[model samples]
Target: MKPDTSTIDIRAMALLIILCASWGLNQVAIKAAVADIPPVLQAGIRSMGATCLMLVWMTIKKKSLLEKDGTLLWGLICGLLFSAEFVLIYWGLEFTNASRSTIFLNTSPFVVALGAHLFIRAEYLSRIQIIGMVLAFAGILVAFHESLNLPDSGMIKGDIMLMGAAVFWGATTVVIKASPLAKVYPGKVLLYQLGVSAVILPVASIFLGEPPVQALTPLVISSLIYQTVWVAFFTYVTWFWLIRTYPVSRLAPFTFLTPLFGVLAGSWLLGETVTIYLLCALAMVGAGIYLVNRR
Candidate 1:
């Protein structure tokens, strides 16, 4: 593992951009594919497929999934949180545009930061961090301002669901960081979540009465491949590697680019309207994320 450093070289920056773009495009792919495969079912399939791929990679690298000492309990907790987060994300996408959902989903950092501050003594928040949190919340309000004015909107429901997803995502992070799972290899930690989610999400889909696949078009197949290979497997591994090699504070601010890419990709691929309000809100959220991650 590379020693943590404040400097982000050109290569690292380029890789970060690629990672963000891949993640941003993932939302668009999910939105397009969910029409054919019910969102929950689609998520389950992707998780299972990714788990298989992860197993192969781990085998090739001679990494032991069982190396984590006493992590089973925390691993299961993280897995459940991961499963819940994706369920809400996929379900929320069914009711709202990808751009809007992506914006709300990015709020996970704010949630994670807050949780860390409250639970981890080492992560106590400074005044600037508090201000960043307030700004982030303000941005969320701005993004949903119109929807809030109109009662009982599908967009409102979708936004709320996405927010719920962000909460779960943040909670998962806290669990991993606070528990014995943090002592394990990143791949092992990921395997626990992927392996457990593979089972949980499918069962949840069945219980939720998600319908069978409507059709398996080329686009749907391609989206599934992308989600399984690129988004869930490769990018995740790359992200873990990057964080291990660099200062997380340096790498984290670049994540704000993800929602920007998400918004642009949604407009380009799905023809979602980019309202002025959304742009203003994105700016606020981006600034807040930068502040929160700043040293």
Candidate 2:
């Protein structure tokens, strides 16, 4: 059965905002955990933990884990993309600050919108959408204004990886839109992707000489719990619910707030400096979101 496409409710908007905000703060948590744990291992545990929880959820809901339909192939492809996205993001964090990472990560919108236009005929971008995309891109640049000025900080490489991660994320979005897995329940889709990522990341960590237990600490555990439970499972489920329940176009613009929240959370939690550039970037992104949402 297809989800109802009707009015966007206030609760959905609130949930979207909360999800974005939680995700924004989640970057800081992951960053903090990295100091006490290897990035890859941390990512692995987060995925594994979330996967386990999702499995329990599936069991409770009587949802089948195995897909009999052709959507299984799409699910695997989507999972591979998801795994690669986090692999880049987690590893890139080792080379860059959370704020800079957030900036580069926001580029996903551009990539996704472009991919959508090319592959999914349903998602044609209007002039306003194009302009909004550009503005959001500018906002990302603004968010990293200070870092851009420092050419000596080895930011070039980190920025590249972060940008690559964003591309992968965009590719995943395209895959989702085009793949038959789109017909599956979001929870089941997430479970499979997380399960795949959980398996892939840990093996990769081992191959990279990063043992799972070597990074285990109290801080690491707490961060993993938070990342798995709140960031991965809860936020994702809530966002999916909103998308399934509300007018997708009306709610889509709120996604731009995530990196803004990331910057703010990074500052508050990690004591990262928030500069005028970030403020300007926030304005630009907010305006871009408004434009994108305007019918």
TM-score of each: 0.82, 0.86
lDDT of model 2 at residue 54?
A: 90
**Model 2 off-target regions past 4 Å?**
1-12, 93-100, 150-157, 211-218, 241-253
For 1-295, candidate 1 gives per-residue lDDT tens digits of 9633445676887898899889878878977887799878888998999999999988998987766389888888888899989888877876886657756786776666667667644555578866766675566566556544443588889889998998898777666666676567778778888999999889888887889889999999999999999988888767766654554434544666676667678889989777776688778866775566566
**lDDT tens readout by residue for model 2, 238-276:** 665554444343455566788778879988887877888
Report the Cα lDDT for candidate 1.
Answer: 0.76
For model 1, where is the 10-residue window of minimal lDDT?
Answer: 244-253
What TM-score, to 2 decimals, does candidate 2 have? 0.86
lDDT of 2: 0.74
